[model samples]
Target: MTHLSGGPALPQERRLVTAVPGPKSLELLARKNAAVAAGVGVTLPVFVTRAGGGVLEDVDGNSLIDFGSGIAVASVGNSAEAVVRRATEQLEAFTHTCFMVTPYEGYVEVAERLAELTPGDHPKKSALFNSGAEAVENAVKIARAHTRRTAVVVFDHGYHGRTNLTMALTAKNMPYKQGFGPFAPEVYRVPLAYPFRWKGDAQACAAEAAEAAIDQITKQIGAENVAAVIIEPIAGEGGFIEPAKGFLPRIAEFAKANGIVFVADEIQTGFCRTGQWFACEDEGIVPDLITTAKGIAGGLPLAAVTGRAEIMDAAHSGGLGGTYGGNPVACAAALGSIETMKELDLPARARRIEEIMKPRLAALMDKYDVIGEVRGRGAMIAVELVASGTRDGAKEPDAATAAAVAKACHAAGLVVLTCGTYGNVLRFLPPLVIGEDLLNEGLDIIESAFAGR
Candidate 1:
């Protein structure tokens, strides 16, 4: 197994030479507080100097286990050789030509690969962008132009992006939407078939949620006015909630019947993160449009909107693009990332991650009442926390316990992240290149945190 990640071969072990945030990190933290905006948040205060494989080496000389993978962007490891090599070559050749003015072969090549890799065998087309929000916004634009409709439908417990329209589509309020109202109009919200929180079994939940969504569109929004129905195959930022079995297919059928575009927001679940090239492939969903980012270009800022050729080409000439859309360097990184995923069989790697992680998380649930559920597919896994000591443990979300456990893990040199509408989920997104030994060590830190709690 080619386990040697980019930088100096970091030994697969945890080493804390100083306190979690030692003198150097503390100094930088002070500087960050003075210069950085207050709205920006930092999960762990430590300053990272280098990261690869399963470890992040901080400026303080602490080798912390990376469980978040920079929010699932570093699936091939932080500095995979191919990504670094291609990006370096591209950088040396030319950093930017502003593809709008003078296009390059790299950008076209990346889009071609996306056309081939994204779900569906139908004739497809792609347009690249700078972020997931950009891709989603463009997808909405294309759908509206094609259908000549104004209304767009999204689901509860689904997060699209942080931009104006995406924030309107997002369900959560406190952080993402609190004081940012007066959002874009013509966006409608519906129910998702969230299995853990739904009223019945998986099949029943799927059936009921589909009916509820259809009913809402028929009455509240009016199906004729709708342009698209967008959803995450495995909803990220809404606690990694995977819809109940059969839910997506039913929704897709509804959209097809109504002439509404079906969009899969695969920002966090794409690029082999969910044991498949795209999460929509699991249920054979062929969306009219798909938004991708985060893991698409290693760690570079790149995203794309790929879909059926007819739908994607509906927008008129010069209708969609940005100043930095499909920048040459980011395109190079994306091509390298795709090559690495194929050569290394990262889809199988993600499945192996699930095999190792799900069992441990399930065991944790078995022992702790605070853990209400262990859910998600492949590497995109999460544990929902609920208040303990009650007969029905899943009744109340336990944000306090989740916070404490995250703090404990940070103190012990394990980088972990938390998410969910209620702030009660601990998400694990280890890099696909992470070694089993280092993965176990990070889990050990989590186990110790829970035991102490």
Candidate 2:
């Protein structure tokens, strides 16, 4: 089936013509290793020639069922009709006039739409940027400007971004923060309501974790000294950990009471990926500021810091923009992305994905001891792998097994990803437009991998 783009559709099936990194791809990988920096990483080295719907065609004639969605950046498909049309028209009109130098209507329209579509009904404003990290840094800047405080609070196992300050804000050490230190100061981390890992009853962990976090903030870092409390409604790179229910509301309340800006890092969970415009809406938690990217502009680079008008305007007039902050093409793509989302009812599609995925994953838990737990919301689903599935005790994380399963799936022409603080969670993020047949085929590959078939 053609996507709304009505573009040349790639076959939405897993077709393995040869081994995964087929000869052509291996040659490309060799060239890449020589040309690319070692610091940058690649998940699957299969050189993609074209992609559409739910499949990506590698140069070696392999059709892989895409579950990563280019790390959730292509949720409306790689070429949604609206996104292509709007961006093409804008590209033809002008590639770059520098929005700051000669402002365009596209930028203004995107900002206006962000205000209308984001969580709260309060008067909101937005500043666009080139990437998620930029949006996050700007959010912190705006929060500090508004609150007149130095300390910024984040949570454990939360992944924000890769910029210097974001690296300090991130909790992971190996790839994200290792050797990147003497980092930015005044960034503090408290406990997340991580239900699966909590020592106490998972249900009770919500209220307790919130209290513990609040206590730490009050005792260690005075509330008056804090500028913002930033968190992900559903922690993304840190294994899609959905904080226990009621946890977010408490933190938001504490931030509100303390005159601190509450920022929701929705880079991964925004758009319709989590069955809603924003994951913060799940519990009626309205953040003071929200940082968004990933699915914001179909597949283009675009991010935004959207928040209450007063908080956003706190930054100096010239403090917020960059030369390429809101490129006309990217802004137009964002408008199309939002349009596709609304017209296709992609949020409902994400919910339907959850309805199909969770049960299949949970059934696997019964069959595979390594599957410790299946958790997440909507299309952003994951299964945590553990060495032991004891009836009553902590499960040992099995990152090796997770990696092996992912490799096996890759060989079978399915693209999947693994994440977590321990790196033992296998996460799936198929495009919202993926057909049910392809989705089932991808899941079948996963099940077969587990069965060693």
Candidate 3:
């Protein structure tokens, strides 16, 4: 393998032989559409045949630089050497026994690693699950069990998951919660510190908003009835919104004083996606419970809840676990992914991605009156679009502009994804191992698309 200054060298620059959903991808898509559920959203039409580091090759002989990283699941890069090797070796030995039933070294090893790597020097424990939503639901269960409280508080624009309880925790309605609710009860929503739109000093605004939210919660539901306050250090699906500098620390203090559990849902922001092992560390706030998924196990479905020992122990003997939770194969992948992350210093690489993206996005904001804001931490970044010239004039995002730019990027051989409540934000979650040349090429496509060139 070729080596670059920090990591492996990129194979080559992007090349497109046909339309994005070229003949091969279109043919496979037609077959997939016939059998797969329509509700499953497909971001780009291109079908990947091979991928490594930062590039995805389609069956139609097109190479596209991946900026989405399979929705932040490939932080170590697609087909990471360590992950592939470990997974293959584990496949040769064993696949599944269900950690709860049979127990295994891999499962225990991963749990121990999590406890060590997660924030806080206190005694911590971890439990593995199948997805971010499961970890979130379990976190609530543990919090409630420990505090003997009923209500759980979540913030606006915070995305927990799609499960019933998490659905209630989530803020966006359409697609996620739209015809699917009769959502679980005992969940409440509060306003978050969105600095871009709010007026005042960033830190003061965050502290005041958090204090007001706590006051509202106490006045309305009473802290005695509350179980936990869940938040994303940097809101992921919620347009990559980063809480103001002092926001997380203030919230952590409020939770501590009120005897409420603080849950950090790091599903998208974890595993070095945000230039740190955990985004909460940026503010030096140690959450009582932290939910993780996305990049934990390379591309495997493994989620975890790591937190204080007392709280986690509150659950009954059989209260936490699942049939496929902590599958051995997935555990192996997680081990490899974590090892690769440390050995290669992916967090520093993530900072490099931020360094590269910030200026390009800033240029876009300067050139396009339609671009409203560019925000995020490290490689987990997003650009929000608004109709030209409007402060309070219909703050609704421009979905059409987002869709047009995404389509143009695809046509020009770049893979991108759109997010946000109004679908007006373009999020970039490129693998930390991405090559500089390929990343710049993808950014160029974004610029060209915005310029309507």
Best by lDDT: 2
Clashing pairs in 2: 5-81
Candidate 1 structure quality by residue, lDDT tens digits, 347-382: 999999999999998998889989988999889999
What is the TM-score of each predicted model, taking all chains together?
0.98, 0.98, 0.96
Local distance difference test, per candidate?
Answer: 0.91, 0.92, 0.88
The deviation in Å at residue 445 for candidate 2 is 0.4
Worst 10 residues of 3 by lDDT: 1-10
Q: Please, what are the lDDT tens digits per residue for candidate 3 over residues 122-169?
A: 898999999999999999999999999989999989898999999999
lDDT of 2 by residue, 51-127 (tens): 88898999999999999999999999988889999999998999999877888899999999999999989999999
Query: Candidate 2, after superposition: displacement of residue 319 in Å?
Result: 0.6
TM for candidate 2 is 0.98
CA shift of 66, model 1, Å: 0.7
* Candidate maximizing TM-score: 2
The predicted structure with the larger lDDT, 1 or 2, is 2
- In model 1, the worst 10-residue window by lDDT is 1-10
Instruction: Report lDDT (Cα) of residue 78, candidate 3.
Output: 77
